[model samples]
Target: MSLGDEPGYGDAPRGEDGGYGGTGQTRTRLPDRAGDVYGGARRGRSSSRSLVTVVGVVVLLIAAIAFANRGDDESAPGTGDSDKTKTAPTAASGEQPVQSTAGGIPAGFAHTGQGAQSAAANYAVALGSAEMFNKSKRDAILTAVIIPSRVAEFESSLDKAYTPGFNKNVGLNEDGSTPQGYTFVSRTTPIGTKLTSSSADHATVEVWCSGLLGLAGDNSTNPVTNGWFTITMKLEWTSGDWKIVTHSQKDGPTPVPGDDRASSADDMAKAVEEYGGFTYAR
Candidate 1:
């Protein structure tokens, strides 16, 4: 809760960060959960497959959703293909980060490797956010960041994965809303990005991130907690921008927990309300 005393995410941008909410414009509700909250329900090549066929499929929807969220790096999107096996660290790329926002999310990423990395970082934040539990917000976010051709596929998988029951388990109501007194906190902070591979039309980037999830309030059973993980997303150059193709997650690269004193529930709640999160991650 008292993240002020803790070290800020090194990759966060110098620009303004927004708070815990969506674009405020709910354009469409893609019935499909779409994008698995970046917890990694993938839109595989198989289209007709029912995500519901396998029980608890999509890898524990709520758990996956709670696993990750936060990053912002500064870099412009580019068009050059990266050399084989280029690993991009969390350093600033010197290029101006994307200045455009498509449907409220960052857009116009470069076709180059750093651009793809930036896209992946920001997309991970959107997908892993608390907003994903809301159908309208979730749909808008997916529409903005996913490959158009595969939007439905991702939605279907997430729809099955992020069910009403799963929502309740994460301390939210079945409708993905917080209870009367508690504040739900779900966010991801990217530590860095690595370009595993890249080409003219496609790229694969892995984001190293730290996430916070659970409910922040006194007597709340789900006290906020944090975790470390890496999200690997396959990206494609589509519609003049890099969008997610399919993504997956794995446990980290975690550092030893610090001995910082934990913040009280009230303090945590106040923090979540007062501070803002980032949308453009480079």
Candidate 2:
């Protein structure tokens, strides 16, 4: 790679000064990928990746080491007392309005409020999914969840991340293959969702989620990865439903974990392969 060359990683997060941050920038005079001075960054990514994996595995272990801790009741389905208090719709016509659609994914949802929150929660699940790392599978995900207009952009951007070298770097087979005996698990559980603001045709939704990522196998570079973050989605109303338009992420309102016995990688992988995801509502 050229010293001044910046390898694009899709839409790199814009820094506070309105320029993209990270080792990928060329104007910043950052150390090159192969430079000894930049070695620390490579180490940091490796360490952070490993930490995410350990955290994911440790969460399972914690289930067995139960102890009392006080926190908000987050497992509930809806946003708040008012939402939980609403009755479920009995018919399709009774469903809420459309906000936005890219290809088929929900985008720019109605500012009706609830739909945006719902979209954020759902989108976080889709983006954090194991399938998002595979092109064909990711296409299926985009078809199932993304808004119609933005589908092409999402596909094009993510294709770079799921490149053959990227797959190999993440410990998957070069063809994005999962090892026969190994189970690859990735999932996101929404802790809660809230509507930050809304209008008749647009709304901003925020979802606090916990995610897990990793492959199950001995000597795996990509063990399970875990992280807690809040995803904010901007939605619009279109046709007769809500849809997602823009999305962003931040660290979290993370909580301390309790002690628990962690499960073996094999068991975690097996459970992931056997279990399926659900369409979340809030």
lDDT string for model 2 (154-179, tens) is 78887876889877776778888887
Model 1, total clashes: 14
Instruction: Tell me the tens digit of each residue's lDDT in model 1 across 1-282.
Output: 322232332222332233223443334323345654422222332333454545456567656555422111222355232321233345466676588997777889888887998899999888888888888888889999999998999888888888989988888899788899889999888888888999999999999999999999889888999999999999999778999999899999988554466889999989988998775445
Lowest-lDDT window of 10 residues in candidate 2? Answer: 1-10
Error of 1 at 166 (Å): 1.0
Position 195, candidate 2: lDDT: 75
Model 2 gets an lDDT of: 0.67
Among all candidates shown, the one with the greatest TM-score: 1
lDDT for 150 (candidate 2): 91
Superposed model 2: Cα runs more than 4 Å off: 1-111
How do all models score by TM-score? 0.68, 0.59
